[model samples]
Target: MDVEYLHHGVPLADYQLTKADRRRQDEAAQVHEWVQRQLAKAPPWSEERWERMRQLLGPPVPPWELQRWQLRLYCGHVVEATRSRERPRPDGGVCDEERCPECGMDPAVIVAFEPPANNHSPKSSRFARRPPSDRRSKAELVAENNALRAELKSLRGQA
Candidate 1:
C-alpha cells in the first residue's frame, strides 16, 4: 500500500522526527507505561474501572496516561487545559476573542472538581452523630399546627 509520511518539519519516510518530537514521544510513552503499571497493581481492570479512569481524565485524554490514571486513583478529579483569548475576524464584523476556540460559539470557561469515589462511611457511624435540635418530624409539626388552630377557634368562640 502507498504510504505518506511526515516527520517534524521534514517530509518523506526517510525523514526522522526532530529532537523535540522524540522527547515528546518518549514522555508520552513513559506515561502510557506508568498507567499500565498502575493498572497491573490490581487484577485486570474491569470496564467500570476504565470508565472511571475516563471520567477522571475528562474528555480528550491527555498524552500521559499514567499521570491521568494517578489522578483518577488519588481522588476523582479532572484537569482542564488553559484557554487563551481568541482572534478577531478579517472583516471586523465578528471576532473570536470573546468566544471559545474549542466550541467557537460559547465563551471559554474552566471547571474543576474532585468528588469522592464512594460514600463508604459505616452504617454504625450514622447513629453516632445526634440529629439537629431545630429539626422536627413532619407528623409532629402537622399535629402541632392542628392543635394551635383548634385553640385559636375556641378563643374566637369565647369572644
Candidate 2:
C-alpha cells in the first residue's frame, strides 16, 4: 500500500518518518478517527432530550433573591439585603449588620456591659475579689489586636 504524509497540512517526504515519529503519528491518526466516529454516533438534539435536560437542571435560579425586610446597619443606613438559600431568615425578619458599610463602624466590638466601680458596687468585697473583666494576657491582647488590624488592612486592600 502507498500513503501520502502531511505535517500540519504541509506535505512531508517519506525519509522524515523516524521509528518513534511514525508511532506517534499512527496514535494521533487513531485518536482523530475515534473522535470523528464518536461525534457521528452522538444523538441529535430533540424535544425529549431538551425536556430531560430541563428536568435534571431543575428550576432556573435568579442571581439573588431580595429579602422581605431590609438590613439596618449600626450606622443607621437601611439597605436591601438578599436572602441566602443556606441560612434561615432572621427571627425579626430584618438583619443587623456586623460592620456598617456607610460609616465603616464594626458593631462586633460594642460593649454591652461595664463592670461597676469598686465604690459603686453593692457588694464591695465580692466585686474586689472578682477576677479582672478581661482575663486575656497582655501578649494575647496584642496578638488579637494585631490580627484584627491585619484583617482590616486586607479588607481595605480588597475595597
lDDT (Cα, tens digit) per residue for candidate 2, span 18-109: 45544543554566568879989998889998999999999866543222223443234443444432233322233322344667654411
lDDT of 1 by residue, 13-86 (tens): 23333565445445545665687788789787789999999999888733322111001101112222211112
Q: Report the C-alpha displacement of residue 134, candidate 1, in angstroms.
A: 68
Candidate 1: list runs displaced more than 4 Å. 1-10, 45-159
TM-score of 2: 0.21
Residue 120 accuracy (lDDT) in model 2: 27
Clashes of 2: 0
lDDT at 60, model 1: 72
